[model samples]
Target: MIAGISVAVAVLAGCGPLPELDGDPTAGKDGGAKSDSETGRGVNPLDNPDGTGPGLKVISSDKDRAKARDLIDKVATKGRGAKTGYDRDEFGYAWADSVDDVPWGRNGCDTRNDLLKRDGRDIKYRSGSNCVIASMTLYDPYTGKTIDWTKSKASEVQIDHVMPLSYDWQMGASRWSESKRKQIANDPLNLIPVDGSTNGSKSDSGPATWLPPRRDIRCSYAVRFAQVALKYDLPVTSADKAAMLEQCA
Candidate 1:
């Protein structure tokens, strides 16, 4: 990852786009931390402020995604060491499946509120609800930018599965106990709130085939991707491993 200071320099040098500052200047960065403008919350990090010249762009293709998914499934079945399946619990279904039924949960996690809490700036719990996150600021780690958390624009930022669940589906997860599957689905280590456009572009892609548009982030992204795959015992395409090694080195 780029040092926080280097990120600030990227923004100042017009290397990247300036993030939208949508919350109180007093509120801190990263959604929950206390804010101070002097600490660089409102800064831009791109080498090009105008967003010209090789800005971040995710590759797109349904065909490639399908191939990736198939590759994951094949490797997962042939590979050993992954949890065979998710363990079921008293809830009568997998953790991920149960959360789907929760009134407030969305997208595999108690997603709506989980993200609200994770992304909101001066977030408040919805009235009388501990499970609900009322509001908070969103700091997009992918681009080193911040955004306001108004309901209208909420979709602009989404909680991305750093290692996509679909990718898991084809991998060892297909054989996982539903309960274990749920844990991976909801695990904080597997999630991040990033720009919707970026997340869509990344859909189910691995390190070798895809990466964040922010050039400064390749190292950290590679590290995180490796850690997650290793943790879950997920299989990686040879290209994926190579991509991660190249970036991390």
Candidate 2:
């Protein structure tokens, strides 16, 4: 969680302005970048191997689809475990910045704000703190919509775990160390900013259970899921893996 403005100001006074990014200054608030346009939000998964760039773009070309399939093939498959004892706190507090060994961790900013800064355009920091986001225009890839979000209406936008934490637990994270779990929880490679309701509907489901509402981005979404799983050496269910492959097929 980000500290409130007054509390964060002194600690983050010199944190500096948000990093400069190359994006359209005049893109409409509802559509920050076109789905096919190579400008603001269309970040190819192959190009953004680290998941530090903007929203996932469609993998439309035959060549890119083949690459996505190959990546998906490398992921192992397994049966999901019982969801008997899983809890969010098991991974650490929500968006803790102090988690060791993940990008943007221990950087004086919470994981939520780090993602907001990564995906939101025209971002506005809180009055006296660069670590808290006050408002921004976000291109939500889950539903292919743009949202002008403010801290006041925080739930309108949510940071989604691409491979959700609970799903991770069911697959194999249940046996991992607390530190490794925390790393997966806060890692940018496993996160994406999307519409809150859409994310709620997903609710730890694997690709077989849910996919992005935007048909065009489903293939890219699968590729991202595979990337996160492969990074953590996690496996999806056989059904989930098949559904992921079908998206690109």
Among these predicted structures, which one has the highest TM-score?
2
In model 2, how many backbone clashes occur? 0
Candidate 1 least-lDDT 10 residues: 45-54
How many clashes in each structure? 30, 0
| Per-residue C-alpha lDDT of model 2 across residues 1-249, encoded as one tens digit per residue | 111111111111113332121232444446674343433465888778888887787678999999999999999998999887899999999999989878888999999999998888888999999889999888776555667899999998989999999999998899999999999999988899888887887777888878776566778999999999999999999999999899889
Model 2's alpha-carbon lDDT is 0.80
Cα error, residue 77 of model 2, in Å, equals 0.7
Candidate 1 per-residue lDDT, tens place, 84-177, comes to 3423242233223244322234544465456455445576666787755545566565665555555556677777766777667666677666
Candidate 1 error regions (>4 Å): 1-112
Q: What are the lDDT figures for the candidates, one per model? A: 0.50, 0.80
Per-candidate TM-scores read 0.57, 0.85
* Candidate 2 segments exceeding 4 Å error: 1-39
